[model samples]
Target: MEVKGRVSNSTGTIVQSEDEIDLRRGPWTVDEDLALINYIANHGEGRWNSLARSAGLKRTGKSCRLRWLNYLRPDVRRGNITLEEQLLILELHGRWGNRWSKIAQYLPGRTDNEIKNYWRTRVQKHAKQLKCDVNSKQFKDAMRYLWMPRLVERIQAAAATATAGSPTASASATTTITNNNNTTYNYNNNLNNSFEVHSGNMMLSPAIMNNNFGGSQSYTPENSSTGASSDSFGTQVSPVSELTQDYYNNVTVVNSNNNNNPNPDYYPQVQDQLSFLDCITSPSGLFSQQLDFQSMEPNTPWIQSNGDTYNGFWNVENMLLFQQLTDNM
Candidate 1:
């Protein structure tokens, strides 16, 4: 099955004949995708260089590998990133920074490239709007105190909505949670791990968090100063079922400039307005050590309003607050 071509050796021996392979480039065609898929399906993966040659694909090993992993793989999840995923990404990035591959490992079906793209396109876009370095203390604090908490709230709200939408599904999930000895339920099957429910509080397995999140020790309620079930973030947190309707109805942004008047428009509608960042300073040791909440101005313009179209990450409150603050500056 070998294709032979002219060959010569310095020793005047034509021991073997080989031809230089003309590797294909650019976007892969359907035929190439099918070829790669079929080859991998039959022979399994690995040995990419030889696999490419054996499969008769004109593409290079690296290109084939990227295509398979990023797109053609059977279990590769697609479409928009979910609220749960967004939360996990923020948590993981907070822990690991730009270790995209490491972060991708925890997020099932998500490729490192996809995660990197999301960070660059969505997360960093918001960071740029904030007019601060992504790595800066102010930005990180804004993420931890404002952005991450809003994500948690949205996750809780979404879970609540899903439960309310289907009584049968909710009942089944409840039954599964109750019967399981480990007290873990993976509501989002797209994720690699399970969510632990204990006394109506959603608990992430310290093992899952520590192992995939690049830590050795488990994060527990005991770790939180507030003595509530907490994630790695050290904030007092709870599950969806435990949070009351008032919790959903009440998210306020106080105007630091105008006698701390509560912004009436700040109530986040779970379906639309779920993401925002405020200038509120955090005392949590989870943020940077050098960050002094006392020294910073009350109405710092953390964001610039360019009238970007509203994505799930940016909402009216964020823009309004930013615009107001920008005016003051």
Candidate 2:
């Protein structure tokens, strides 16, 4: 249909085109979807306005773009979001608030719209139920301290279970990290023995238990038979522990010997318990630690539940802990 001049139709609202063709909306039909897919496959994507017309699709350019990017694309991943992904979404949202496209870059296969919807439906709902603003420090602290740790615990549990039948395979889940000082540390994932992901250099070890937030205590898995010895940092590394140590050693090195002559005393006790506590409490410092973006699964959808049963997250124990934490906050 071609635009002739301004005219009013059933609604008596004057529109730009006199003989305007009614554009299709709502869910796309199978034929329309196939046409779009075939057109793109033959000619490639971009120039959405002309592509829509050329492809004989009555949908608007923006609509077609959204549909392709969010749904019909070959690489669009679909399924239930895994625990690892949930942790990542929370972490990324904290960093780049409302910048969905930027956050989507880190989480491969996930569309920005999906992430935004998940935040609104799941995260914001929980915040509303708690009777606090989603951006409030109290709620953020609850997520950082309580919810996020719970997610990490779930991810570890899932990973452990996934590799359970293959102890040999799990043990092979190791990463070699090189600090800025040119010191290389080989990390292993010997989850059976201990939760301590020791750096080969014995630099810093962080605990990965439910309540051990930044505590230096060593943890051994149930019925494990091994123990740490000299040069014992050869176990498999959990994502968080590995990322934390790598970030500290490579990104934020504090050397007392540097003659740059400033407040070198800033983090005097970098390797002490207090520093670990600081890492835990400081939201900017804690979640900003880079994750293994490659390990993230395809676009998966996850939702958090209300009180009494939040995907096994909000038990009496966690509720009490959250209260105690918020009170402190």
Candidate 3:
């Protein structure tokens, strides 16, 4: 195929190739994909136009490059993005605005096009559902508070299902919950590094359950063997305490000296009467807290519904946002 052209001077004139071979366009075929792959594999990539000609691919340099990078590349990950990937995209987009290329750097194996499509389709659709601009603060808050928690729960549930075949846990199937009284916490307003994760049960550092109740109470599973009794933290914890250990699912605790939790003055005014579901489930309203991402524990795992441990971060608002999701999923 030849493309005839005309010539013109540089002073507001058009110059074209006398005869240029026409390049192919539109959808790539299997042969083209295999050709691109074999060419890159044998000769490596560079000078893409020359590569395309050498490989006998009827495509332009730009077309060849786009096809290779966005579609035929061996490393390009396809299918639904994981919850972790979605969270990272959301966090990065918030930080860098619409710089999709830069955002693509953080998410390995994902192309900028994929992230943009997801945002425009799912995220923008949600914003439209709420009748708000995609760039509005309300939409961002919805992403932060609602969608993130949902994703984390889904991730946790999936991970748990995957690991369900592992060895039977000592704590699983026992309606009688155990509390490691040896376990201690900092139920105070300063929740940085509240408590370290131990062998079983996600432990609360400063006592999330103690905010409204009188005095600090730590539930130790070891001593939880006997019938309920008033013990260490000055509150009554049951052996099969409705508030069991898994209350701290997908919770990301920071080790910051929270001079800025935003809710330092806010106090929880609840009764001692609580259940396992109560501790993990989100309150009726959105609970806001100032979170400093610097203090987070990297790659910390959470316990899923089946007593299996899985890795994911708490969305950093309130802990119970995804509580109901475990059972529902």
Candidate 4:
């Protein structure tokens, strides 16, 4: 009966905890945000646990830290990521893999959480929709050859529009794509290797995206206008499933002494000098060394190539050939 009586006065018997005040959770309130910001402004950042306590924020240290680093920081940049920023994110992500914090270091004012969100929501969404592994070889190829070019085109388009509106911008805006590395860039392609297809408008072939895409390798004037002379066009079955796909899109190779190819058997065949650097630019060593591409079913139509188009899954041999053709291009 005594124990029962003791328990009956729940409020009286139980000593109030030091943190008896209400602890807020979930989305932050304007007042709470102001409190956090003002407290940080006066005291500066760090010592999150003590900061939260002294700041009068009814939140955990981690919560306060996250809000400050991700949002409240004076330098933090929000809103949609620009094309240049997007390219950097992809490149940095490729180099660092899931190291969001490390990747964020390269992007000024961009938060790790923002980068992670962009990768998961925008980048991985494509892979998920395609039903392919985000870390597969096929998917990587799609990103390099398909998606990347699309990003480049968008950047160029935006630049052009901006220049047009100002009228003071030069044609150099379109021709000069800043190198990702601090060094200079000069693209091998004359910016007209083939059809100027936008990523949003272009249709991707399922067969070409499959791991066994080889049949589509035999691209010609009827298929790709990549400026490859008709005589230079030849069919070669390339096992891209094992082939090395260099992520250094248009990374310049410096062979000095004013010399020609010392070894004709070198891996990448030497090509004619470029009038300008490859439009694509990325900070060197920013992305993972090289990642395998993931690929799956095509949900859209393929561009007309010699009147041969795929409406569904491809045959094994044809799929392989398609991959080879894409590789050749």
Question: Model-by-model lDDT, in order?
Answer: 0.47, 0.50, 0.45, 0.44
Quickly count the clashes in candidate 3: 13
lDDT per residue as tens, model 2, 1-329: 32234567789987765123667778777677767766776677889988998999877788789887877653333444434446667766786688887666544445788888878888898788778899988888767766776655444443344334223323334456555555565433222111221211111121232223322223332111111111122243323333334443444323234332112221122232222233344554544453322243312212243211144455456566668878775
Worst 10 residues of 4 by lDDT: 237-246
lDDT of 4 at 229: 13
lDDT of 4 by residue, 133-168 (tens): 778776666665455444444444333333333333
Q: State each model's C-alpha RMSD to the native.
A: 17.9, 16.8, 20.6, 19.5
Look at candidate 3 and tell me the lDDT of residue 52: 88
Per-candidate TM-scores read 0.52, 0.56, 0.48, 0.49
Writing each residue's lDDT as its tens digit, candidate 3 over 124-237 gives 765675566878776666565555545444443333433342332332122322347644432222121121111111112112322222223332322220111111221333
| Clashes in predicted model 1 | 0
In terms of lDDT, which candidate is stronger, 1 or 4?
1
Q: How high is the lDDT of residue 29 in model 4?
A: 69
Q: Which segments of candidate 2 are over 4 A away from where they belong? A: 1-19, 166-309
Largest lDDT belongs to which candidate?
2
Cα deviation of 14, candidate 3, in Å: 10
Clash number by candidate, in order? 0, 7, 13, 36
TM-score of structure candidate 4: 0.49
- Which regions in candidate 4 have their CA more than 4 angstroms from the true location? 1-21, 167-329
